[model samples]
Target: MKIAIFGPSRRVGVVVDNDVVDINGAYAKYVADTTDTARSTAAAALEVPADLNSFIEQGAGALAGAKAALAHLSANSITTGLDGERLVFALDSVRLHAPIDGKSRVFAALANFADHMQAAADNTASGSDKATLSRLVSGGPKYFIKDPRVVSADGDDLQFPRRTDLLDYEAEVAVVLGKRGKDIAADDFGSYIYGYTLVNDWSIRDNVSFGPDFQYSKNFDGSATVGPWIVVDEGLDPQDIDVEARVNGEVRQSGNTKSMIHSFAALGEYLSRDSTLFPGDLISGGTPKGTAVDSSIRDSEGGFEDDSAFLNPGDVVEISSRAIGSVTNTVTGTRTGKK
Candidate 1:
């Protein structure tokens, strides 16, 4: 089930045959029709809410119920809920939102990719410190918290910030947690994962000089571009996925999840050490190299001087994975006209 939370109403939906199914409404209708209860609609909403985050909180039963509801819709040709609520829609007919919004926390790993870490080491480290990035994973995955307020959805416009001229895009695979757990073992990560999604970890290249902190470079209110829909966890390997990024349709970054110095299991275990992992909380597992700054030093064809290297007004930045899906956000004009 590729589940999504979409549009102005923020309804939870399931993608089937390239169309969006209002799973919550369908589930409500299913519950109302199957059982003898006048308040079945209200009951269904409580049992299996229409919002993705709330729905996720219901855990496996709601997941199973929603799947059965979708199956019921298909089996019976159901088009609308009991109160005439829309139960199905064309994929492009409505807006797509980040699966979890305001309902969860986002912790993003830094330099999870060996190639990316190597690139960073090559640029900044000297002597024995250069290119020896194995120690990163040896110490386990490290992350930084991203302000959830900055999360923008697929097809949304990312407003270019006026503070820096070096806006960049990073393509990453984000793990969406399902069950809350503390000090979970690496082997149990599969049970706790709900699904996977894509995230463009937007950055301000020039702002790093002021950082030991990332707030100035990474959390500019529109930096977290996430989702098309979450590809539900159904026993798939999170450590073996593809990652790609394109700017204005030109492929700029490409790597696989297998290249991660730290695997999903390791990262999940690291995150749950003392804190609770909750449903809808995202673990943005860092990005692969070929970011603008990486290319500013590594690209063989002198790609650094290219105006298309960094985001500018009207550039569409797309982050993708074959297993999860893709998300594209167009970079629009400044938040203010300061620049």
Candidate 2:
């Protein structure tokens, strides 16, 4: 089942078709109106948290509670007086926030896709060695930490950094962890994962050559675009899902998760080696071959003269996947001065 935080109150919601059911509100009312024994049982069965992060931390219990609550609302519709019509809200009536927020560490893998690595390598200056890309292919999955502050929800504007002119968008599948564990095995990744979400790993191409750290380019405010909603991992295979990105309305990036050199499970194992992988922590499984800055589309002078290839102020970027829904954001604001 898909879950989201929507409306003015940012209440927890369960997505049913085109409507969102207020799970938290409904469960609270259910507890308040029921008998003492019933209330206790309901409370135990549905330990629904106020936010998405806490709800995910509850793991299987949360899933079971949500199902039970939905079942309860369906079985005794007249008794509760909170039927589908009253509890469910149309998708357009509410606004979405970053599904996982508040202390969720965002880890992103780099050069995990062969095509992306090749494209990035080909885009570099002539005679430049692609040792890093080669290392990524041969060695274990390499990851970088992204500031959770950069996370923006669907329909929100992606704020352009004042320091750079070469902004780019990367389409990736973000894995959300359900449980905390250290030295987690790759095979046991399914048990640890709570769900999956779409992520636009925005980057500033100009910043890469000027600095050794990627934080300056990748971690700017509103760079990481995530959400629409989270699809729970109920026998879902994230490794073979279709991922794509579009600017305005034109398709730019198109690839599959199956092309990933390091699978999500492998990346999970690598990430959980020394540190604890907690619930709500996000791990983005890198993008495909088609970023705006790809050398394949560059001219002989090594410049992309085409304005449409790169993002400009007021441009809309939509990242979509079959397993997870689409995350659409517009470039509403940009700063021109040097930092």
lDDT (CA) per prediction: 0.80, 0.78
Clashes of each: 0, 0
What are the per-residue Cα lDDT tens digits for candidate 2 across 174-253?
Answer: 88998888999999987888888888999887636423676677788888888988898457787888899998898989
lDDT of 1 by residue, 1-339 (tens): 788887689988888877898877888888887888888778778877888778887877777888888888888999998889788999999888888868598888877887887675564433433333445545667778778866899988888888877789999998888877899999988888888888888988663632367566888877888898888845667888889999889998999888887778888899899988888899888888888776654333322344346778878888887788888888988634223
Each candidate's root-mean-square deviation in Å?
Answer: 3.6, 3.5
Clashes of 2: 0
Off by over 4 Å in 1: 123-138, 207-211, 298-308, 334-339
Clash pairs of candidate 1?
none
Error of 2 at 318 (Å): 0.4
Best by TM-score: 1
Of candidate 2, the 10-residue stretch with the lowest lDDT total is: 77-86
Error of 1 at 79 (Å): 0.8
